[model samples]
Target: MIKARDALTKIKPYVPGKPIEEVKRELGLDDVIKLASNENPYGPSKKALEIIDSYLTNLNLYPDGRAFELKTALSNYYQVQEEEIIVGNGSDEVIKLLSEAYLNPGDNIVQADVTFSEYEFGALLMGAKVKKVPLKDFTHDLEAFYNYIDDNTKLIYICNPNNPTGTMVTEVELIEFLEKIPKGVLVVLDEAYAEYVADTSYPNSLGLINKYPLVVLRTFSKIYGLAGLRVGFGIAQKEIIANLEKAREPFNVNLLGQVAAVRALDDKEHLEYSFRENAKARESFYQECQKRDIKYVKSHTNFVLMQVEDADTIFNKMLKKGVIVRSGSVFGLNRFIRVTLGSIEQMQRFWQVFDEIGG
Candidate 1:
């Protein structure tokens, strides 16, 4: 038998929601609506499909290692220097690269206890410790996060509009937290669902890059509707980007992803369309929760976390009904369930099944 690193001892496998095809196959259902992963219900933009179709004939050739064209497009879009960006297979890879670059056996990362699991997974991969801060009022407690920092801390993660809960910290609180952090600690503002946020008070993470040693990560997977293509990028100072680039694999993002992402960035109409529709659907979900007198966390992301009785049972029941949602046990909150807000017809079907089953 081979010996693995001690770090593997502390890690648990990351569980994703059941896929639509698998559910359909197992349950023998023709129509399966998945609100489990916060994916865009409308699917990819037409422009991205056109771009991908053009690139399909060139599959035999290796992708451009530098990703020069996509990087240039992102530079122009975000008003940042080309050298200030690092694109990855997904934002998940960049997080792993950061951990590889900075974390050591004793170094630690600080994040909310119930936020994104990737932070802990990345840290543990490099044998780094994790200090988990409890969320106050179902949102990131900035004060508590500040207090958790110490000399051994190497990275800090704030998943704005955090996963599972979908709640966020305001702009003022974020600025204050960034201002007081000790030098040398890298802060990652994970805004995976930033496009769904309708709140004007959400922090402008890009504007703070010049002032702090941090990275702003955004994904094409959410509102951009390109999750299957697997493209996400990070914005930071040139120096931070340089360090991360050293650890990035060549052609980490495929040819199709680069083309699709560039095309997606240019399609503002598609972006806004998904945004407006998601906002409308999310509100309807909120109203349904209200009408049913169910307690739910106000969400800036596309998912809502609702406290329920026997979440695992309700989760299985929803799955059996061909409407798949996430059970809160995946996030350490066994009495709650997280449901993604989807299209009006999808949401209506979900609620119809849920109404019958009684969550």
Candidate 2:
């Protein structure tokens, strides 16, 4: 066998949430509710769907390599120059591009130990060392990230309203941390669930990009309900975006994704409605957990990480009942499970199944 890179050994395969179809097929059941991936339960805007339908005729042609129209729409929406944004197949690809553009063998990147796994994957793929700082109070310990950084550190990942835990650092805290970052190191803020957050303290990240060596990652996958489209993007200073652009594959984003994302952006009513509904569902989840005497981390994102007796057993039980949720074992939180906030009906189904299994 041909030898693979030594770094490949350090990586673990990512386990995504079970697909609804796959679960139904395997369990021989008709109904399955997926509250696993932190996807928008309320799907994409009708306008987006219409645009996608209209664009079907363009399938034979190639997508705009630079995604000019989509970038223009994003620029207008975010009040940023088009040159500052880099669209990707997904935010995951942009993460890879950042690693390709900056990481080198012997260098290191800093991140929270229990945060998103992709950061570690990207660093390892480029043969860079991953320096993990433990989360403080189920949130990114931004101050601790400073200690992990040294001359060799090239990137720092802060997953705001972090995955799995669903906690976040306040704007005041993040600004203080950003101020202390060294000149050479770049900070990547993965705000994939930013649209779901109702906290007034959330950082207005786009404003900071001009003053700091920072990149803000956003995704249509979550709030815009375009997960199937796989459209995500990064906003940074022109220099950083230029470097990342060099590493970006041509037409990394598909034609349908670009059009859908553009329409999704324009549909402010749909965006507002999704946000409102998510807030309501998240609060209801908290109330339900409290009623059952279940301990849960306060979530700013669309998911809640709740403590369970045995996550693996509960997960399997829930799966058998046609309720799919993420077991916390993947993130090394063996006693917890992360569930997305679904619609009222879906939430009712989840609770019915959960109660039946003694969750």
Q: Judged by lDDT against the true structure, how good is candidate 1?
A: 0.92
Candidate 1, which segments miss by more than 4 Å at Cα?
Answer: none
Residue-wise lDDT of candidate 1 within 1-359, one digit each (tens)? 79999999999998998999999999998889899889999989999999999999999988888989999999999999999999999899888998998999999999998999999999999999999999988999989987899999999999998997999988899999988999989999999999998899999888899988989999999999999999999999999999999999998999999999999999999999999998898788989999998889989988999878888999999999899999999988998999998899999998898899987
Clashes of 2: 0
* Number of the top-ranking candidate, with lDDT as the measure: 2
Candidate 2 lDDT over residue span 1-359, tens digit each: 99999989988888889999999889999999999998988888999999999999999999999899999999999999999999998999999999999999999999997998899999999999999999888989887888889999999999998998999888899889989898999999999999888889999999999998999999999999999999999999999999999998897999999999999999999999999999999889999999999999999989999999989999999999999999999899999999999999999999999999999
Q: Give Cα-based local distance difference scores for all models.
A: 0.92, 0.94
Count: clashes, candidate 1: 0
Instruction: State in Å the error of residue 329, model 1.
Output: 0.7
